[model samples]
Target: MPVARVVVDVMLKPEILDPQGQAVSRALVRLGFDGISDVRQGKRFELEVEGPVDDDALGRIHKIAESFLANTVIEDFTVRVENGDAS
Candidate 1:
């Protein structure tokens, strides 16, 4: 059976400071990657569904992202379905 893959990308809010990302940026510059001005670290979650994705499933996934995958106060997230993601 085919499976549906949903991706949730979570990131710190723009106003929130990202020390980890800053450190990476500095490291990249030291390693000869000078063109990069900045970097921001985030998280990704991939969820597998047994059937095709629908509006109701999307809504449920969004709720899961809001409640468990991301911090609403300091982070933001986006949910999207992978068109051809296969294991």
Candidate 2:
């Protein structure tokens, strides 16, 4: 059976503070990396499923991302479906 590959990116809301990102940005500056103004940390998730994925499956994945992967109150997420490769 063919498989579907899904990728989800979760990031903090604009108003939410990201201390880790800030620290990384500062470190970069200290290391002489210029032109770096701001940074925000995020998470990426890759999922593989057996069989072809449809709209219904996408909806279910979105629900899972919103409920289990991201904190909707302080974070937002985006889901992407890859075309051919499932690995």
The 10-residue segment with the lowest total lDDT in model 2 = 78-87
Clashes of 2: 0
Top model number, lDDT: 1
All models: lDDT?
Answer: 0.94, 0.92
Model 1 over residues 3-87: C-alpha lDDT tens digits?
Answer: 8899999999999999999999999989998889989999999999777689999999999999999999999999999878355
Tell me the tens digit of each residue's lDDT in model 2 across 1-87.
877789999999999999999999999999999998999999999899677688889899999999999999999999999777435
Give the TM-score of each candidate. 0.93, 0.91
List where candidate 1 sits over 4 angstroms from the true fold. 85-87
lDDT value, residue 3 of candidate 1: 81
